[model samples]
Target: MRKMPLRELAERAGASPSFVSQLERGRTSASIGMLRRIAGALGLTVADLFTEENEVGHRVLPRAHRPELPTGPGARKYLVSQRPLRNVEVYVGEFDPGASTGDEPYAHGDSQEIFVVLGGRVTLWLGDQDEARSYELAAGDSIEYRTSVPHRVANAAEEPAEVMWIIAPPTPD
Candidate 1:
């Protein structure tokens, strides 16, 4: 497979070089409009960029090969699934004390999501601000919900927390 240089992609997409770099590194999220522009520049649709192509053989993706997605200053997630993404995507999240997705809740595409607390304690907030519900999860606890509504996750404990996230039919934006 061929890869486009970050600078070249940024130029083609009419985005800042730094923004493109951040996107490539999975350190940031892009708006639908920006995603469309980037995909168009690459001669692909937003879905085309995410859906995996059919291959004849099976492959193994070692731990080192997993992509890291830094959500914020003190929180990070690792994409544990193979690329390009398949029907479902898995992520392992690590959050330091006081770390969170953000102060405000955010929503993704209409995919179904499951969050499992692997270790430590964390809190999950879901739905719109007016009717938001909060859940405190400990190790081994899990919750399932749709990604259409806004949500936020945070580690309010003094210790670090680990969680697993599973999403089906990965969304483009």
Candidate 2:
């Protein structure tokens, strides 16, 4: 993987080094707006950041080959691609009942996110300005919203909740 220093990347993106550091280390989560700014500063599209580099042909990510990142104790995320690295990102996330991706609110630059409920229910918290929104999703329920403000998702059902999330420019941190 080609990685850049946090300080240099932050300076290039016109963001704080600490913020960039947090993002790189996955210590902080970013909103859609922040993601756009960082992507633009880095001369990339939202999808580019999420895709893997390929020299000749397209790569197919099998279920077993997908990168399952640990979001929390009871949460897991499978990233969908490895190319473009900027404009868009697709992920399948699963959260056990009472599990959370993060305790703090997540904010980033300009972008949008689409969440398709595959199973169970989840409570979506849209920053400190709005009240939590709860939705029970089966196989078809979906929601789309801007990612400029801080937000989070938690499983509210007794069983595990599965969601497919598509974010522009990918999420920071």
Candidate 3:
């Protein structure tokens, strides 16, 4: 391993020294691009930062260890990955019957979102308030939409709906 100082590493990554230091201390966040640059400077990949090296860098995340993401009574979600993924986020959501993410559609920043209905059923609405369309989703069904256009998810079935949502850039608008 190399013993490079923060300033040197930051310079190599084309990032500010303070920014790199803050990132290392977990006091701030960095975009995927910046993280990639830093990783490249260190002769590593972005995934390397999140690798759980129990058996030589396996990224596997067991159910018990997945972090829970707080939500309203409508849904219960678990962040299905360890922290520090600058590029993407994966969440498993258990939505109760008649529950929804919200009554209205919302848009995040320009990013792509994909949803998979793992169990039960759900109604996915895509588009803004002025113009929108809803699609029915059954178990094993999947859909992708532009988050920038605004969207919402709801469980209209009698049973709970389980879904896996993957978003790029890791930002929810």
Candidate 4:
């Protein structure tokens, strides 16, 4: 597969270089308008960007079959469903105490995220918002919010915090 620098792609798409970088890194979310522009520039449909091409008679993703991707200095584990019919992506994340995804603020297109805290405390910062909301979440505490707003997640406890996240349309290129 051919890959392009985010800056070049963003320039071609008339988007900010930083914004494009964030999207590529999955550090920020994008708006619907932004996604359209990017998809157009990349010669891909939004669905094509988010969905994996189907193979005939493919088996499901077993619990142990999910690939783990790096999430900054912390661990963000994920499992894309075996069935390709779903429109959302599910991730299981674990953060060490005081670890954050990044310090930058990012925005994305028409996406929603629901985070269920499995243990410890989590601090969330929303786009340009001055105040950071801290939640002392246990096994069942959940918070759902729009992904369009720039946001960041951090572990604010002495122990590792576990979270389950679901994002719509997935993170874009």
Candidate 5:
């Protein structure tokens, strides 16, 4: 893969270059949601950050063995059942207090994503931002929408929130 310029990536991810440099040098770690946005800007899934390049088969991925990263100040993320060349991808997102997916919504190709709230509460903004319908979800709640439609995710409560996302046709590009 061609490497993206750090400054360019920082701009695209809405992060400061100094912060991105620190992250690259292991001096700091961005939340999983933040990392996801950076990856998305680079045409990759957050899972891509921790993905192994070796060819492998479908095997059980123990929680302890799963790769994790921070998304923002108070968020974390995990890649579950990651098959680099497969057609499906699974992700786990943990948000603390004010943590969120991002400030803007994004759309992609022909695909749908399933969002399941496993703990705490979260809000989903579906459709155009101006006229988006807000869907508040609590533990055990689930919702699905097409990737072609713009959408966003955010924590809806003061407590921490955990959610799982199943993406079809694999994750982003």
Candidate 6:
């Protein structure tokens, strides 16, 4: 859909192009980590890969049908937006104590993003080490930032935390 070459996608996802080719051909299965990396590289949430093209007529999405997005250890996310993706995409995220997106921050495409803390507290780390800024957000707090900025989100409290992620203009593809 993005007209991205397999090699390029593989390079971004940190996998061999041949492996990506095999996976695309249904000759191989991708681990959760690989799937997450591929989705990120393509400027998409992992669950976007499961959206069926023929679901245009549906008006309601049942909980049983929601796609679970693959995330890092101790963290889980679910796709909350309908597909054939429009101007925005949403995800509901749950993080256990000390859970985080990763140890390192990452950046995506040019889209903008909003992160809302629905429960507990979370720390939002923005930029690289030298210029990093950290915001401790409690329930009901939210932060908006560019998706292209290297950032990471982590659970700041010992208890579980819930968050909502919203991104605009859905990446290119």
Best by TM-score: 1
Model 1 pairs in collision:
none
- For each candidate in turn, the TM-score is 0.68, 0.62, 0.64, 0.58, 0.62, 0.66
Backbone clashes in candidate 2 total: 32
Model 4 worst lDDT run, 10 consecutive residues: 78-87
For candidate 5, lDDT tens digit of each residue in 1-173? 42457997788788999999999899998998889878876556678778776556668889888888556667788988644535577889899988887788877754778989999999999998899999999999999988888988889688999999888765344
Runs in model 1 lying further than 4 Å from the true structure: 1-53
Whole-model Cα lDDT of every candidate shown, in order:
0.83, 0.73, 0.80, 0.70, 0.80, 0.85
- In model 5, which runs have C-alpha deviations exceeding 4 angstroms? 1-58
The per-residue C-alpha lDDT of model 3 at residue 82 equals: 50
Q: Can you write out model 1's per-residue Cα lDDT over 1-173, one digit (the tens) per residue?
A: 22556786788788999998899799999999999898866545698667656562687878777779758889988988765554677889899999998888989767899999999999999998678899999999999998898999999999999999898866545
Model 4: per-residue Cα lDDT over 1-173, one tens digit each: 22556776798689999888878799999888888888866645666557655543656777677868667786576665433324666777778888877777556654688878877778766656566554456767888888787777887678898878787655443
Candidate that scores best on lDDT = 6
Worst 10 residues of 6 by lDDT: 50-59
Candidate 2 structure lDDT: 0.73
Predicted candidate 6 versus true structure: per-residue lDDT over 88-167, tens digit per residue: 88889999999998888988776889999999999999999578899999999999999888888999688999999899
Q: Give candidate 2 regions above 4 Å deviation.
A: 1-11, 14-56, 129-136, 171-173
Task: Give lDDT tens digits, candidate 2, residues 60-99.
Answer: 8888888787787899999886545446778898899899
lDDT comparison, 3 vs 4, better candidate: 3
Error of 6 at 107 (Å): 1.2
Runs of candidate 3 exceeding 4 Å displacement: 1-56
Clash counts per candidate, in order, are: 0, 32, 2, 7, 8, 0
